[model samples]
Each structure stands twice: as C-alpha cells, then as structure tokens.
Target: METRSRVLFVRAGLPEPALNVEIHDPDGGWLATSDLVWREGRVVGEYQGAHHFGDYGRGDDDIARRRLIEGSGWLFVDFTKGDYYARPRRLALLRRLAGHLDCALDPAGLAAIEDSLELPGPPVRPCGA
Candidate 1:
C-alpha cells in the first residue's frame, strides 16, 4: 500500500515520498517511523491496514502515535483500503496531499494515470423503455 501510494504520487506528478523512514525531533529523539515521509514538506503518510485496528488496543496506540507525531509539527495523513482502491477517493487523496505539500498537479498526468488503472467504470444507465 505504501509503495502504491508512492507510485500514485509520482504518476500524478508529485514528488515521491520516502518509505518507512524514521522521523526525529530537533533534539534527535526518534518520534516514529512513518510509512511514507516527505521530509522537506514535513508530511507523514500512514497506511492503516487491519493490523491497525486489531485487538490488543492497537487503535489507541495509533491515536497516541499520531498525536505525538503531530505535536512534533509534522502533518499526518492516513489512508485505508477504501482510500487506496477507489478511483475518486484516490484522486481526492492526491489532491489533498498536493495541497499539504504545496505541489501543483498536472491534470493531464492525473487523467493518464486514471486511464491506466483497471478500475471499474462508472455505472451504466438504462435507456428509456
């Protein structure tokens, strides 16, 4: 999912983010290793899978981790399966990321990427009977 996210950004003409990089504070204290990190943009992206919501209070841990990272002044963005697999959602997500990173998107590039994906097309309408 992280790799896919990276590819999505690249295909959309956005800067590719680092994968599984450790974020650190000014004092050099390790904050958390983000699934995706745009260092210059100070943005962290996380892919939340089933493990993130599994038993053993993992959800709580995720919330705390996000708080810690945000408190350290990094913009946190999380993506779930839905956000990844859906086309419209993916476009929206990319736009949101672009806004956060102050990156301009090429509409033609995004259209090409969307065309390349084997996603299901829009619903068909029945002719008037």
Candidate 2:
C-alpha cells in the first residue's frame, strides 16, 4: 500500500512524503507512527488496509491518537484500496491534498500516467513512476 501511494505521489508530481515515520508532539511525546508523513507540511497519511480492521480499527486509543495529532495541527489522510488501485482517482485526490499543503501537481505528469494506463501490458503494482 505504501508503494502504491508513493506511485500516486510520483505521477501527481507532488513531493513525496516520508514513509513509516512517527509524528511527535511539541514536548517530544510519541503521537502516531504514520505510513507517510510530511512534517513541515504537518500532513500524515495512513493506508488502512483490511487487515487493520477488527478491534484494532479506530478503537478508543486510535481516536485519542488521532486527536493528539490533529490537536498538534497535523492533517491526516486515510487512504484505502480504492485510493491505491484507481490511478486517476488517486492523482485527483493527491492534487486536492497537495493543494491543502499549498503545493501543486503537474498536469502533464498526470496526463502521462493516464496515457500509460491505456497501454496493453501486464498490470504493475504501481504503473506510475
């Protein structure tokens, strides 16, 4: 899922967020270990796979952890399989998120990704660069 998300960021021409990072509070308290994190932008992304469901999914502790991060002014993006599989949708969504971080996505890069998707070839985990 992290690889897939990285491809989306690449195709969208957005700066790549650090993978598997831990966000901390001002006093250096552990907040959450995120799948993707852009500390300067205060944006943290997590790919919530099906395996994360059950009592582990959004439990009381998880909610509190989220609140801690959000209270520290961090923006969190929870992505699912849909966000990873659909390249176009991912690109569009990345554009929106990038905008929230005061960044821009390159149109040509997204267009190229769309073009590649139409090619006749074996499916790649992340067809984008």
Candidate 3:
C-alpha cells in the first residue's frame, strides 16, 4: 500500500504529501475514504485492490458509490495493481491529470522533491490525483 501511494505521488508530481483522507456526503454521511485526498483540487485517489471486486455485492456497491461521488463534482482516479506496477502507463495517467488540472509542478521540480525524500528512484503520488 505504501509503495502504491509513493508511486502515485511521484507520478502526479503533487506539491504536498498524500494523506489518508475521507470525504463525506453533503449531508455528512460517509461517502468514501480515499487513500489520498487533494482537498484544494477536489480530487480523490483510490488504490483499488482485487478484493475491491471480490464479490458481486461489493462491486455493485462500489459502482453506486462512485456514481454518487462523481455527481457531487469530484474527480476520482482509481488505480489498480496493474497501474501501480506499470510505470509508463501510470506516468502517462499522471501527466494527463497534471494537464487536466493545470498543476504547477514541472518535471524538474518533481525530481527534486523525490530526491529530497531520501527513499529511492520514484516518488509518491499526491492525494486526489
């Protein structure tokens, strides 16, 4: 899970670190708990594991939840295991998102941020990307 989050941050080039966040419905009902939430950008990052679709009932519920969230003016980026493991595809998605959101981070800035992390090659994706 940490690896996935880190990859997302690196790919998205977000300015802030990804934090565990949850969004509630307008009525204060539980909507979804996102792996990362970029509150300023109104985006949600979801790391979907295979268990997310392990059952028919769960899958149906997920679909309904997603619809409700989307209707509420939030963009969700759902990443599966494949997306986390596949660098090119994941990076492409991140770039597309950066373009869509008009994010300020450039590749160099992102690289510097990743380097400062003191971890490894990649960086973590910001929340809400």
On TM-score, the leading prediction is 1
lDDT for model 2: 0.72
The per-model lDDT (C-alpha) reads 0.81, 0.72, 0.63
User: Residue 66 deviation, candidate 1, in Å?
Assistant: 0.5
User: How close to the true structure is residue 25 of candidate 2, measured as C-alpha lDDT?
Assistant: 90
Across 3-103, the per-residue lDDT of candidate 1 in tens digits comes to: 66676777677887888999888789998988999999999999999898786698888898899899999999999877767878888888999999999
Clashes per candidate, residues 3 or more apart or on different chains: 0, 0, 8
The better candidate by lDDT, 1 or 2, is: 1
Question: Which residues of candidate 3, in runs, are more than 4 Å off?
Answer: 7-12, 109-119, 122-129
Tens digits of per-residue lDDT for model 3, 3-116: 555554654465453567778777787787767666777777677788897999988988887887777777877777665456565555566556545685467645543433
TM-score order, best first, reads: 1, 2, 3
Residue 50 CA displacement from its true place in model 1, Å: 1.3
The TM-score values for the models, in the order shown, are: 0.84, 0.78, 0.70
Our model 3 lands, by Cα RMSD against the true structure, at 5.5
What is the Cα-based lDDT of residue 10 in candidate 2? 57
Task: Report RMSD (Å) for each prediction in the order shown.
Answer: 9.7, 4.4, 5.5
The candidate scoring highest on lDDT is 1
